[model samples]
Target: MIAANARIGVARSAYFPSLILTGNGGVEAATLADLFKWSSRAFLLGPLAGTALTVPIFDGGRRKGNLERANAIYEEDVALYRQKVLTAFREVEDNLSELRILRDQIKTQGEAVDASSKAQRISSVQYREGAINYLDVIDAQRTVLAAQRAAVQLAGAQAIATVNLVRALGGGWGNATSPDESTQSDKDALTP
Candidate 1:
């Protein structure tokens, strides 16, 4: 800004005062003030502020689509859980029934084994005394072997049923929020 009392001497010649002098200190000051004001208010010139214009996207349709997808997944997870629970109950029921049937079969096999053992003992004695042929002894031995095999098979079936029951009931308890957890959002992100 020019000061009224400030020197305005001309340097065009050794001695010359023909040049006119004028003070523009107030004019310079007003011009600077206007520049500052315009710069300060430039931010309010648009629909959204400058920072808001560049803000991360949050489209309404996109958000709605995401919510719909999440809801579908949550329903599906619930359905899966229901199915698993039903299957587990069915497995337990099936095992109980199978175990009961196998127990009956085992009792019958035990009686057969006992009867075969007695028959073989009698056949052995008769053979030794020459009352029965060796064929009787062979047949008795075969019957005992068959009875033992039957008992073993029944025991195996019982064990298999028990294992299946255990597997059907989820091995252990668990905890977690599935697709139904808090709203699906990018709220944790810095840009959000």
Candidate 2:
């Protein structure tokens, strides 16, 4: 699958690592759906689960999705905890994996960025000595700009990877301050 590799991207390879986090939205939605299923399952298979705890927040008096009274509380928070822990572990693992990939991508990009910088500098010196024309400066500037963009994108990737790890760690989402928030932002942007 495109997601398994994180490199089968829609954009250029230089930008794909950072863009991979966008894929996390899809992963999160599905995971949340599953968590909701298991969390609410306590009410469904009450006879088997045992005694369900009264989670006041999710099961309020609102007419929402399907769910009835707490039937048999699955006296095993361990089951729910197991589900949460494993899911969290997967998310964190994937995010960390992405971070490693992006880190490598950044290294290559950094080499490019450094080369571009040197080229630009050399071009500037040549232009100053009148060995080249204004066009030379323009080309150097363009290359530098492209390399800088790649670096910015990689920085964004590192940011996204950090946020994914935090989200898996069960932190809240927020603006730029948190990974969960940045993830929501990406998903929101992808939405209407």
- The digit string of per-residue lDDT tens for model 1 on 1-192 reads 122112112111212223333322211224655755534333232333222323324455654565555556666666777898888799889988998999999999999999999999999999999999999999999999999999999999998887777767655325534554423433334354
Error of 1 at 166 (Å): 2.4
Residue 71 shift from truth in candidate 2, angstroms:
11
* lDDT tens per residue, model 2, 153-174: 9999899889878878878645
Clashing pairs in 1: none
The TM-score leader among the candidates is: 1
Top-lDDT candidate index: 1
* Worst lDDT 10-window in candidate 2: 19-28
For each candidate, what TM-score against the reference?
0.56, 0.47
